[model samples]
Target: MGIRHIDVRLCNGCNICVEDCPLDVLRLDEATKKAYIAYLRDCQSCFLCQSECPQDAIRCVAVHERRMPKAW
Candidate 1:
């Protein structure tokens, strides 16, 4: 695993990220009812999805090292 970003509270499975991402790195999980970073290595860290998220639950952070786990 590389790095990851997700806002479960803000993510409503609207699939906006799926439609907006140019890299095709995001996906919606039907079972968990949330968004998943299928290819985190492909992330550009552009904050596009974060800006599109209406719930304001998205955030970008470094993934090479470990700091906090399970954060939006």
Candidate 2:
């Protein structure tokens, strides 16, 4: 497994993050006016959205498994 969990508070609902996600994992929460990644397994670790986010809200972090090494 990879680090695909997105920080919701950091998201600004700018939609840039959704556009940059090549894996189609990110989806806009029409109700919350934020972004959500429903298909995390599809993520490819490409930090395109992070690079385009003006608010610096989008980020790609490594989600370390319990039995695995801690996140750096």
Candidate 3:
């Protein structure tokens, strides 16, 4: 679990989530002008995108549910 949801209805194409994401986990759709999770696996559960969203459209799962990397 990482980014759980993005409410497109509330989104205003502000691109805050896309710009504030430290891991580049989110992206803005050129056509729809909405933010979406482009790299779910890369999400670090930092909640930066969620907190920075002015529309409050971003939601993320807790860190305990985040995916763990496997050892090589």
- In candidate 2, which residue ranges exceed 4 Å CA deviation? 1-5, 62-72
lDDT of each: 0.72, 0.70, 0.85
Candidate number with greatest lDDT: 3
- Which RMSD does model 1 reach against the true structure? 7.8
Model 2 TM-score on a 0 to 1 scale: 0.68
Displacement of the residue 34 alpha carbon in candidate 2, Å: 0.3
- For each candidate in turn, the TM-score is 0.70, 0.68, 0.84
Q: Which ten residues in a row have the lowest lDDT in candidate 1?
A: 62-71
Residue-wise C-alpha lDDT for candidate 3, range 1-72, written one tens digit per residue: 468899999999999888888888888999999988888877888888888888898888876455467797
Question: Ranking under lDDT, best-scoring first?
Answer: 3, 1, 2
Cα error, candidate 1, residue 44 (Å): 1.3
lDDT tens per residue, model 2, 29-72? 99998987777766666667667778776667655324545588
